[model samples]
Target: MNKRILTALLLAAALVVSLVGCSSQTGGSKPVEDAKTQFKSEMKFYGSTTLAPVISQLSTSFNEHYVTWDKVDSKFDKKDIAIYVSGAGSSAGVKSIIDGVSDFGMVSRKVTDEEKAKIEGYQEFKLGMDALTISVNPKNQLTKLKDSLTTEEIKKIFAGEFKTWNDVDPSLPKTEIVVVTRDIGGGAHEVFQKAIMGDTKVRADVIQAPSMGALVTKIIENENAIGYASYGMVNQNKGKLVPFKVDGIESTSENILNGTYKVSRPLIVLRKGDMLPQEKAFMDYVVSDEGMDVIEKLGFVPNK
Candidate 1:
């Protein structure tokens, strides 16, 4: 072979090796870049009024921090990723997911067998715990009622057997007691019924509110009215509502954590079948240490 021709061939071979090396390095990183950019366009969460505020705050934090692909990039569009949180009731939340109306359903209680039957292979994620607090209007004259009522006495009062305040405690006034309760299908109502009423039905004469906020409003407006709500709701309305001790145990986070609060229930999110990557990511953030911190701040006992 000619010397010049051999040298040219060697140089071409060298250039081909360098090009292959460069391609291998860059091509290997393409998948990593794609993983970083992958995200859901939107996610919809509906259910449990009790879990709404906490999830809503989480949605905000997730959108602000986790949803971003590049935090330092000035052109990164945070609005492209969206999370919608709303609550009708736990039952509604579950139904919404079954009906294909939402990406997730939040419930403040364990999934009922009936609810489980609605969707094949549905899964529940326990995010936190919440104690149901009995509340009355702050102006009610039965001031000692909070400290004195036993579980049996509470059952009697809600059962309509004790029609007047004096019927439960002779020391109290004879004013007709106004019973308030959550409407059927609320997870809070389900938990309250199991924990407080047992086999006894809540009286048909009682006033039923559609949501925790509405129930709180009803209790606050009527001095003679009594109702139950999540501890978080009562805590936020402390001045307007008086939280009662259940079986002499105060509905505190510590009591819930220590297992002394009898009225407590699990807060959960439900999904049917396999979770999408975005849904799994959101759930991951919810159970993370940072997410548990958010749950604790909302007055619920963190699962972690």
Candidate 2:
């Protein structure tokens, strides 16, 4: 064996080793680049404390079941979908969408024409129907005196015209009636205003609760309290409170679904401008049969 031939063979082996290393590096980098091309980014849905519980749970289930937002766009990335939900009230949710701060907005009432005009290409989705129930503590004297309230009487009670139980009815006690309400920013407040108050105003001294849950708790805590809440929340508290029939119509599922519950409002979601692939994907899921099932389970009348 010649020394030169042995050295040449060693050099050839070294060249092969270098080429193999380069191939391995290129192969390793390809998958990472491919992964980057297929990612779906996070989205934020803000608004409607009433709708928050439903949407939050739906988002959780969506993230769990759909690894990617492929239901709407097959070309979308294969990353897990993330929709962060928070409740700051319905008006706040609408403002967030208008300000480009949120991908979607949830509202428990219909969007007034004025609100829709502010956003370009504004779109809304109806999730369900929720009734606004006139609730009082089960122990309230009114429960013993009356099974129902006329719309006109409700208007007077909230207008501060009727200050005491005796004012509402002659036979009841004279204890001062406690008027409770959601803040003006809440969709529930607006619904109550339109449906029952008409041009009348809520009493200046009304107790304003921050959310439906808070309003229910306030009614439960105060025997003299009278206020409005979503029928769903009222049903959740069941025996703890009494929901008065409005104009002889109860807020039953049949009444709400049949449009006989005059105080009910639609649960809605809004998005402005062109729909993002992820946004459309989510919105579609929220109205699907499965999504409607979630609404029904949460005690609202599903739109379907």
Candidate 3:
């Protein structure tokens, strides 16, 4: 074969070998407690909102196999894992851990100095990057938006100062915008406040949803609803939800990686920078190429 063809064949062979090696090395859900165990002790975990999807997958995969512990009742030798993920806001998760309510807390934004001081034996680690996406329902005809609205303008719209869509843009329809927002305790709330609302509280007329799932549901149901969600949650969507450009930049991995997505935030799995062997392994798995595969599929930007 020609040199070019020969190189391509060699590369293909190498890829196949690499894939096979990974397949054989990976042990899916068999008891790992007894085999080269790295954990000093078995443990359970609960995580926060922004980290919910990734953490849940990690927890489930971890739980499938025993980790340094035998099954309590080994008659059937059922899975003896204890990791559980509770979908709460980042603030709630941090508070829970600080108050001794959970094993760990997850947050997309950096923990504040005041918050850092509150957790006694706590620490945080960044997992990846995520962007906050602005969205509107499908039926709304207003398409063009300013590259980036001022923080004041964003607050005013949510606060009901700009009551109708046309109020902000006279060329748009006069439909009353039904603003949907995250619950008060949500991490999204924190980011939105700091990035776009300054310190102002959400307007009274804004509809608050308990979770991102609910927020999406409400937005989809109400053609007039305008809301925000993590790029991961809504990027895969089609026409039911329309994500607007932020400062003329699309919230894609490309834009985020290049530092153009203004709202991109890091996703962290907190457990102190130094991890126990098991924790280290789990964290590594998450940021690893395979782990990033999951993140990408979920519509979030992977860490550069």
State every prediction's TM-score relative to the real structure: 0.79, 0.82, 0.74
Model 3 Cα displacement at 88 (Å)?
1.2
lDDT, candidate 1, 1-304, per-residue tens: 9999999999999999998788778783343446546555678889988898889999899878755623413344444557899988888888997898898898888787887988866888898888878778878877654564688888988889999988977888899999988886577888888888889988879888877888889888899999886788877776888888888898888898787888888889988888866567678888999999998887778898
Candidate 2 — number of clashing residue pairs?
1
Task: List lDDT for all candidates, in order.
Answer: 0.82, 0.87, 0.70
lDDT of 3 by residue, 69-91 (tens): 33322332233455567777777
Clashing pairs in 1: none
Q: Quote model 1's TM-score.
A: 0.79
Measured with C-alpha atoms, the lDDT of residue 231 in candidate 2 is 83
Two-way lDDT contest, 2 vs 3, winner: 2
Q: How many residue pairs clash in each candidate?
A: 0, 1, 2
- Candidate No. with top TM-score: 2
Best lDDT goes to which candidate?
Answer: 2
- Candidate 3 lDDT score relative to the true structure: 0.70
Superposed by TM-score, candidate 2 places the C-alpha of residue 256 at a distance from the truth, in angstroms, of 2.2
